[model samples]
Target: MASHSSSKIAIYGAIGANVAIAISKFVAAFFTGSSAMLSEGIHSLVDSGNGLLILFGVHQAEKPADARYPFGRSKELYFWSLIVAILVFSVGGGMSFYEGVEHLKHPAPITDPTWNYVVLGLSLVFEGISFFLAFREFNKSRGDAGFWATLGRSKDPSVFAILMEDLAALLGLVIALGGVYFGHMLDNPYFDGGASICIGLLLVSVAIFLIYKTKGLLVGQGVEEETLDALEALARQQRGVEQVRRPLTMYLGPQDVVLALDVEFHDHLSAIEVEKTVDELQDTIRANHPEFKRIFIEAKGLSGKQRNPLAPDPTSPQI
Candidate 1:
């Protein structure tokens, strides 16, 4: 997971690059009448819009917890990320696929490809810069983890979204360049349309992958199993804790987690002792795992029974 500030830097870089590339690619597409170039233009435009949506999500997710949203609005980032993926699939991929099919039906040879090459070159440069920035930020978060593992475990969507989009943009630019070069060389426009279709498929694949990743976060994914195990172990070390059941945890944001621990204490402990133990355990856990913003302990007697159901301990806080 990346800090919000790091995520913003990557997204802002992508937005700036995509906005410029989209304009130039559209101009080139209009002049050359190349299907692939047009598809690349649409891709850049969609990426630019996605970056803006991600920024909006980050802003909304930053809201403090209130009466209406006790967990804060951190998951708003996930919701907007889902929306961005849908837009990429429906608008970017669908439009490109439709345009490719239409172009294949009536193949139009490029009259002049100089502008196409120029735009593609510049687009590649800009997209590369964006990709580099995003990859760098992501690397900081991933640490020693492998790419696929890090991606699967990552909670922040903004960094990965921009990284994937920029990578796709770079690949799309290559395809468009190949289409323009070969279409002109072989005098076959079908190749250009085929390239557009390839780009469309690429965008769709990326969108689906993103949707799968974001869906888990939107639906309240928990912290890793290892984290839960470590937390349980820490709780078991408390002075009065007899048994620490497995802890339950969920991520509220990239860095926010809510944890619930069920612990069985010895029957001999007094209410005051229980309160002191709970407070000490919470401090220890917080010191170790700062991301666990909310911690609730369910103090249990021997054999998973509450110490007393008739009246709760006044000094012991549940949250």
Candidate 2:
């Protein structure tokens, strides 16, 4: 995931593009009476609103940890992301399906498709720009991974959320274009209605995926595997650490991680030595993985500890 500032650029760019496109599409839908265009308008409007909602989430998430809510409001982003998914699915997708079915029932003749074409063409350009911006920012966190992998592993939802919205908008525009053109050619408004329904289904799928990811993050996802490995290595490198237990990690936010570790010290280490080793291990881990906002280490060996399945014992005990 990109930093908070970089994510904001993507969000703001999408908001500007979507707002302008929504207005134009609404105007065209009004003048042309095209069901496809109407659905497209709703899609863009919802996208714009979702961008605003993400911005609000960012603001709420940045609030410092307080006495009442000690972990900070970082999960606010996850909560609002869930809200965005629900809105996109229910309002944008459901409304599109409704309008499409209604048009299919009535089969009202589309008055003029010229305005629909114009609006769709402009929308394609603006949405493409937004998508490119989002994709670029998203790629920063992806590294050598494929697009699908990057999307699945993305910690920050705002970037991928905008990416999916823009992609859906572009596809919806194409479907709308085909519906308008073919409806005029074959003189069948059913084609337009069918296209709208297809667009709605597309949006529903995207919303479902977003809902799944956001909900997972809200429920407390963990740090990357590489980071976890690094934590274990750091524990083993400590001066008096005899064995390293499994290092547990969970995210409080996109960039915030809470880590818990249990380490077994040397069999006969003094209390002072144990304390020194614990402090040094913490400092090293923090220096290596700054994402760990809170780190807790427990000396499990002499504290009447139970043998943990996850810990690895060294062949020979050191210091």
Candidate 3:
């Protein structure tokens, strides 16, 4: 619950920063008619939209399990985070490209350079602060991993996604400032259009990268191998667990896992003993692995036959 609250707060901060940056970039673009500034404005506007989606997702994900969703609503975060990534790619990247192409075809004069620089400089500072907050939140879970590796491997996609967005925003600001300075220095609008195109490409790359990473989570990727190995070790150490045949685990949501295991017990163990063993194993798993939430234990005889009458037949086709 505390983690969810923290996530919500971080997303809200990102939303606020993006909204302010959007307004600043819009005003700067209006004053200068700079293609790069305009492209950045669209980027921030899209970021603002993505931030709102993340905020909504975080809230929805906090809902408890119900009849309709026995596994809980945690996956809502992944779904909405994916939607946010797509929006960034389409609205932010696509619009930037379209504007850049139009600018290239029909060059527009950038009348005022001073205001563009001021806005870009201020945006860079604001985005840096926002990005720092995201970084701090991500580090809470990252432990010893490097920043880039943490971004790639962290279970919480929101912080990493926002970090990428902020980095892109910072790069866009640099591109916009460069375009304005070079356009004025070289007396060429083409340079400005080219810079906008570069910014668009950068945003597209970042968006696609984020989508690719988050798609794995949406599709029910397995827990980390290290986590599984740890769970297996814990189960093996239990006195009644003869063997852990197959341990299957999947991420139910960020930092939440559902674990299913097939275990063989001694042939002479009574039904009561088996139940006690299973309960002990479940408790051990939960105690050792903070991420594992729901555990399902399938007890098997020495001959590898399931003890439960309702267990699915091995040869039966699954739906």
Measured by lDDT, the strongest candidate is 1
lDDT of 3 at 8: 64
User: Which stretches in model 3 have alpha-carbon errors above 4 Å?
Assistant: 308-319
Tell me the spans in candidate 1 whose CA falls farther than 4 Å from its real position. Answer: 308-319
Question: Which residue pairs clash within candidate 2?
Answer: none
**TM-score per model over all chains:** 0.93, 0.91, 0.93
lDDT of each: 0.87, 0.85, 0.82
Candidate 1: C-alpha lDDT = 0.87
Which residue pairs collide in model 3, if any?
none
Q: How many backbone clashes does candidate 1 have?
A: 0
Model 3: lDDT to the true structure: 0.82
List, residue by residue over 247-314, the lDDT tens digit for candidate 1: 87888778788788778899888877887888888888878988877787888788676863222224
Candidate 2's residue-wise lDDT over 1-319, tens digit each? Answer: 3488899999999999999999999999899899999999999999999999999999898888767777788899899999999999999999999999999999987877889989999999999999999998898888889999889888787788989998999999999999999998899899999999999999999999999999888887887788778888888888767777678877778877778888887667776777767777766776777677777777756455633323112311111
- For each candidate, C-alpha RMSD in Å? 3.1, 5.6, 4.4
TM-score of 2: 0.91
